[model samples]
Target: MTDIPLEHVHVAPEDGSDGEPAPAVFVLHGRGADEEDLLPVAAELPDDRHVVSLRAPDPLQGGYTWYELDLSAGGLESSQPDAADFRRSLDLIVESVEAAVDAYELDADRIGLLGFSQGAITSLSLLLEDPDRYAWVVALHGYLPESHADLDPDGIEGKPVFVGAGAGDRVIPDSRTSAAVERLEAVEAAVTHGSFPGGHGIGPQELEAVVEFVESQAR
Candidate 1:
């Protein structure tokens, strides 16, 4: 199990000047990153919504992680984290989103998720398992987690999703990316897939695409 407990999360409040209940976007970081890690991306995103970033629950090396991993055991796709621990992380993310909505008076119809790597795992899991709660998703350099195998594909039809992957990423092979897209589409998610000419990380080009995707979703 993870040693670090998730008690505090970081949030960037929105300035809703239009006297409307602005939408809120929950930002989740990759493993080994903190709540503030994705704040810059949040800055680049549309400023119309509240940007709340969540930290994972487990401690690792000098950073934190969503769950334990066995990297050398044939890469991430085959490797699995503790199921119970994964479930808890999933629940905590949902709780954080709900709490933010209540505290900020956010529009219930405009909540979204943005995640990278392990954060992608958590965000994707929550959105897939409970499609009704999230309006859209943006997952960066990630694949489906093992615990999410039982999601009903028909549960999230017509939902918008943005998937950004690295074409040269040695960590998560293209096979995994293809599978992820297939799975999301099987559930009938309108996936706007983009590939960058990089390896295992998000680039400026990809971020531009993501920003465009986020804007389109808001409309």
Candidate 2:
């Protein structure tokens, strides 16, 4: 097993890389979910890309969470992340990406991030922190964290970002996703927003759009 920074499951490229470093898409699941939760979705992505699904570091409830949520403000809509835990998790993800690149023989220039909910939030934060590090990002049912208020990194100009939101999602609310889209657009990232007709999860159409997005990048 190629040891990276986090617990993960690596899915090899269906089409061999032909001795060249292959592109990779790293998967990050939502809170209360594990690495295996998104394997099915990962399977639908481009076959030429290596898929690495990572388990969150901190165990929570029966699953795992990228970081703890501060619900003291009331419902999930008002909840914010514990800043310290968020930063720590971000650092760990960065380390894991570096290790994954070397161990998996991945093309570092084509790294993509696909995340859900809290995982989506982390992906957006990572892109903002170091836009040049990632080629594209897909965040489903997630919002930009408040901790990034002072962060406005350069080099993110024209970065591709996909923000997906559910119209009836009470857990995250569509407004939050809209705000994230605005923020990404303000930063000059090429933002493609998709709205589903369901609640806090990815629907069939949403998944299709995600696949299409990843396919475009893979080619």
Candidate 3:
């Protein structure tokens, strides 16, 4: 796969202002999902925040993936990501975010990221790697990989972060959630984590909380 994600789309604001650059949100889908998967969530975000949904770089069975998964260690909790592709995808996402800012006249200082499952892993990976690059981050049904070690957690201070997970999620266990929280705390991030009643997918309550987070950060 190329170092760039293959597909993307911009969800423009209906009441956008002329000349004033709008704040933006980048939405990423989980494994086995497409760019169109998060469009409904995009449609629910605060109207002032422009949306960008991206497809993963590496194509899987019928869908796409940010990186290859290695579950040989057993269970989803012990899974590993292909280091090379993960880094490549991160580079591509950063490039895309930069390009989106320039092309859409977006406010770079106010950009937030939202991701689900594998998408969430990629999003949090980027945020932790360079905490200064994002205004906020929302990680859903995902956890931070122990392999990402170049981060200065202290730089994430005051940065808004929301971690939404399903209490009954067999895909992501509580151990992973706790580990993610510990990692984020080490960096001093302003975090809001919520666990709802569900499994591996996003629910209405999750959406509402995540939307509130992005909207609050955009303000």
What TM-score would every model get versus the actual structure?
Answer: 0.89, 0.97, 0.93
lDDT of 3 by residue, 44-147 (tens): 88888788898888778788888887777887668978788888888989998888888878899888898999988988999988888899999998998867
Work out how many backbone clashes candidate 1 has: 0
User: For each candidate, what is the lDDT?
Assistant: 0.78, 0.91, 0.84
Supply the global lDDT for candidate 2: 0.91
Off by over 4 Å in 2: none
Candidate 2 residues 1-219, lDDT tens each? 546879999998988989999999899999999999998998988788899999999998899999898988888898888888998999999999999999989999999999999999999999999999999999999999888744779988889899999999999999999999998888788999999999988889999999988787744
Tell me which residue pairs clash in candidate 2. Answer: none
- Give the per-residue lDDT of model 1 (tens digit) for 37-85: 8888889988777777777877776678887775555765566666777
Name the weakest run of 10 consecutive residues (lDDT summed) in model 2.
Answer: 143-152
Q: List the residue pairs that clash in candidate 3.
A: 153-187
- Give candidate 1's whole-model lDDT: 0.78
Please say which candidate is ahead in TM-score: 1 or 2: 2
True-vs-predicted CA distance for residue 78, candidate 3, Å:
1.2
